[model samples]
Target chain A: MRIEANTRRGQPVTIYVDGTPVQAYTGETVAPALLASGRRAWRVTPWGEPRGLFCGIGICFDCTATVNGVPYVRTCQTPVAEGMVIETERPLERDQ
Target chain B: MNPEPVHTDIAVVGAGPAGLSAAVAAAVAGASVTVIDAYSQPGGQYFRQPNPAVDPDPQEPRPRAGRELRHKAEAAGVRFLNRTVVWGAFEDLRLAAYREDTAQAIELQADAIILAPGTYERVAAFPGWTLPGVITTGAAQTLLKEQRLLPGQRIILAGTGPLQLVTAAALVKAGAQVVAVLEGASPGEAILRQPGQTLAAVWGQSTRLKEGWQSWRTLKKAGVPYHRGWGIIAAEGKDSLQAVRIARLDRQWRPIPGTERRLEADTLCLNYGFTPATELAQLFGVQLHWRPAQGGFVPRRDEQMQTNVPGLFIVGDGAGVGGAELAMVEGQIAGLAAARQVLGDSTLTRRIEALQPALRREQRFQQFYARLFTPGPGLDELAAGDTPICRCEGVSKATIVQTIHAGADTMHAVKAVTRCGMGNCQGRVCGPLVAAILAQETGQSPERVGQFRARTPIFPVPLTAFTVLTTEGAESAESRN
Candidate 1:
C-alpha cells in the first residue's frame, strides 16, 4: 500500500525478502518495502503470534529481521540496497 | 587491543531539534562538537526529513527547516556521525557508538555530553494490541512522512494528544480512508470551561494553533467522525488487524459500559502521548523525578539544564515531554552552557538568557496539553488478564499481575521474575505501561514501583557489529569471553 509520492528522484533498487524480490527506491527502508509488497507480519513469535512494526522507531525490536546474513537487525532502521537479502525471523517448524 | 578513542569537546547524542541546535550553538561558540544520530538525517522526530540521498520532500516545511538547521550546524564546524547509535555511556563520558552500515565502532571521549535522545510514542496496552497491523500513531506518521506509504487502507486513529488529529489529517491527505479519530478527552469542551488558560496557552502559539486548526478542518472537510471522550478499547484480529473496538470514556478514561462500538479497519494507530527515552540517562545514574503528565520520570536538572552528573545535560522531549520548540530552546541553552563549561568561555551567558522567553512560552504550551489531553487514569488499567503487557517478550497481563501478587511488585522485581522487559526492546516498549500497571496493581506510588534500571549497550547491538568493527576487541573479545 504505497501511494506514488512521485517525489522520488533516487534510482530504483531491488531487495530480496525471503528470496522474493521487492522493488524499492534508494531512500526506502526494508520494512516499508516489505509492507508495500503486502507482507504485514514480519515475524512469527515462538508462541506463533504475528508481530510487525509496533514502534516504527528503532527502539522496539518487533521489526527485527535478518539482513544480509545478520540476524535480528531492525528492519525499520535498516535501509535497502540492491540485492540486499532479508529474512524474517520465525519459529521453527518443529516448534510450530 | 588498545587504540586512541575519538576526542571531542562535546558529544551531543541525537541530531533532532535539540541536538542540532545544541551542536550549532556550541560549535558556533568555538567548541568542537560531534553529533551522533541514529537517523541518516539531522532532524530528530520533530523535524523528521526523508532520507537526504533522495530528492527533498517539497510538500513539507520540516525538511526545509531541518536542512537549514543542519547547514548552520555544519557551517559552525560540527562534525556529524549520522546513522550511528550511542549504545553505551561508560565512565568519564566515554560513549560506545556503532555504525551499523559500516560496522564502525568508536569510543568517543567527550568533555561534556548533551543527551537529546528524544521521545517515542507511549503504548497503552489493550486486547489484541500485539497483533500485526496495530501500530503507534507515530508509526503511521513515520510511514507516510519517511517512506510515503499508507500503513493500511481503512485506518482508525485513537489516542489522547493532538498527534492523533495531525496523523488522522495526514492520513486523509495521503488518500487513506481514515475511518475516525478517537480522542479520550473533550478538549474543545474543556477549553470552553477554562477559556482564559486555553487562550493564554494558545495566544503566542499561533503556529501550533494554526496547525491544529488546519488538521481539524481537514478532518471535518473529509467528513471524518471526530469522537471526543472516546478511545479504542481493543484491536480485533487473528494474525493481523481487521477491526478495532472503541468506546466512549468517563472522566478518568474508563470505558463506559454499553458505549462500545466496533470499526472495521486494517490499521489501528494508538498513542497515549510520548515517554522520554531515559535509558541513557538512567544508565548514567541520573536521579529522575516523576511528573505523570510530562512524559513520566524526567531527569533532575539544574538551572543550567545540567543533570547531577557534571558535564552531562539532558534536554528536549528526551528530558521530558515538551515539544520541538521547547527542545530547541533548551538545546540552545544547554549547548552554550556545555560550550562554556568546556571552552572556559563565560560570555555565552547572555545567549543562554535570551532563550528564556521562548522556553517559557513552550513550557506554557506543554502545560496546556497536560491540562487538555493527558490520558485519564483509567487508561493505566485497560489491559485485561490475557492482554499482552510486554509486546516483545509476549508476556501476558496475567503473568505480570501474578508476579506482582507474588510480592514482586516493583518494575525491576517484576522484570526479573517474569522476563517482561528482557526482550530485544530492552523495556522501551513495555517500561512505562508496566511501571504504571505495577503502581496500580499494588496501589503504590510510581516512586515505589520504580522505573526499569538501564544497563550497558542500552539499545540491542549485534555481536557481529562489535566483531565486524572493533576487531581488536573482536579477537580478544571471544578469547576474553
Candidate 2:
C-alpha cells in the first residue's frame, strides 16, 4: 500500500546539535541524521549509559532531543525543514 | 545539585527477554551493563507475572518455565534497576530517568545500546469501545499476570487472533466463567485455502496450542460454547459493559438474519492487533518500513537485528511482534551481533546462519496468525454517531468524519483539529482506530492512513508535573568533568 510519497532526497536543512551547525535533509529527524552523519554521541556523559533510540514509538521518552532551543522535542517526530536549527543541550527547568 | 558522570561500557534499557539477553551478552564480553525498566522485574510486559508473590491465582498451579527464567536473569550479573522511568535521552550517552520516587537524572556513557522495548496492544474503534467495561486483551492479561486480578467472573472473549482463545483458556483456568470464545475468522477456512502455511504453523505451535486447545476443550466439555463465525455487534451497558450483542456472519461477513444473540457479561475483551512501539526508534532516526506483518512502522533491521544506526540495535516486539520464543532468539542474535560489532569481529555470517531457522519459523507462525484473525465485519461500521474514537480526550467518530469532510486530508490535520492523539496514553489506544476511520472516510487504503503523521510532544506529560521553566538553575559542573 503505497501512501503519498511527496518526498525527494537531498533537500537541505539545518540542524543545530548542542548549538553546533549540522546539515540535514528536509524530511528527516535530528537524531537519525546525526547518527547517519557520523555523530554517534548526541549529548555529553553524566551517567554511564548508552542512549539513542529504544522504543521507536513515543510510549517511552528515550528519543527526546532539544529542537531550536525548545527542550524535549522528540527527534523521531520532528521532521527537518530548511534552516531549522535544533539545539541538543540538557535543559535545566527553572522554577516558574 | 547532585552532579556525577556515571560511565559504563553499555546501557541496556528494558529488562525483558531482549534487554536481559543483550546485557548478559555484552557483560560476558566485559562491558559494564545497567538494565533499567519501569517494572520492578527483569521481564518486560511479556514475561510478566514472574514474582510469585503477585501470582495470577494463588490457589492454581504456576508455570515452571517463567520461574526458571527469572532465577537465571537474577544470577546473570546484570545490574537490574527496577521502577525506573527513563523520561528522555540526551546526546552524549546521557539519560534523563527518574527512580525510587525521586526526579533525579542518570547519565549513562556506554559504547553500545540495545533497544528491546516490547509492543503494546492496538484496540481499533467500534461502538462502546470506550465504555468502562471494555478493556484490551493485553490489559486483561496484565491484570491477571501482574496483580492476579480478573475483571469479572463472567467474561466474553470476543476478537480475532490466537490471543482470544489463549486469554479465554487463562480466564477459565483462573476461575472466570468464559461464556464463549467468539473468533472473527472461520476456523476451517485456512485448511481449505492456505493449507501449506496452516500446516507449518500447526506444526510449530503444536505443543502450545495443544495445551490451549486442551484447556478450551475442557471448558467446552463443561458446556462453554466456542463460536468461530461470530462477531460482537453491540456492547450494552449503562455505566459499564453489562451485556454484548453478537451475530453470525455470512461468507463476506455481513450479519445473517435471525442469528443475533445477546449474552450477559460484565467485561468484554477486545484486541484487533498490535502496533510497533517505535517512538524511540523514530527518535534515534532509524529507518522504518510500514510492515503490516511487523505490526506497522518497525525499524528496518538486517537479519542480525542491527538498525540503520551504527552501534544501536533493536529487537523483540519493538522490532516487531514475533511472540515470546522468537523475541528470545532475536534478543540473543542482537546481543551476539552487538558484541561482535564492539569486538570488531567480521565473521558473523556463521552466527547469523545459526539464527535463521528460528526467525523463519517465527515469521511463518506469525504470518499464519495474522491471516487467521483478520478483523471481524461490521466492527468499523458499528461506530455510531456518538461513539468515541479517541478515549483520551473523548473525540467522537462524527467529529473526526466531519473534520475530514471539512478538508482535513491528513491525520495530522485531523489530530490537530480533534486533539484525539494528544492524550496521556500516547495514542496507543486511539491512533490506529482514527487512522482506519480516516482511510474509510477518504476512500484511501489502510496503508495510506497507515502513514499517520506524528507531531511533536508525542507523549502526554501532565502540565502539573512540570514546574514552569525558569532561567535560574544549578549547574551540573561536577558531573560534566
Task: Using TM-score, give the best candidate's number.
Answer: 1
Q: What is the interface RMSD of each candidate, in Å?
A: 1.5, 21.0
Q: Clashing residue pairs, candidate 1?
A: B16-B44
CAPRI quality level assigned to candidate 1 from its DockQ score = medium
Taking the tens digit of each residue's C-alpha lDDT, what string does model 2 give over A1-96? Answer: 001122223456776665676767653445446644544334321322223432222342434566656665555445566666665433233211
In lDDT terms, which candidate is top? 1
- Over B1-481, each residue of candidate 2 has an lDDT whose tens digit, in order, gives 3355466656777777777766766666545667777665566765654223323222222234444454555566567667565554444444445553243445454566788878777664656555545666765665454434455657888777777777787777666788787877786787678787688886767766776677777767667788988878778775556788889876555668899999998778886667877766665567888777668778899878887777778888788877777777887787777767776665654775797887788878877767666664356666788877775466889999999999997888898899877765566667777877887889987667754543223345434222322223322211222
Runs of candidate 1 with Cα error greater than 4 angstroms are A93-96, B57-59, B464-481
Instruction: Quote each prediction's TM-score.
Output: 0.95, 0.75
Scored against the native two-chain complex, candidate 2 gets a DockQ of 0.02
lDDT per residue (tens digit) for residues B288-310 in model 1: 99887788889999867899889
Candidate with top DockQ is 1
Fnat per candidate, as a fraction, reads: 0.92, 0.02
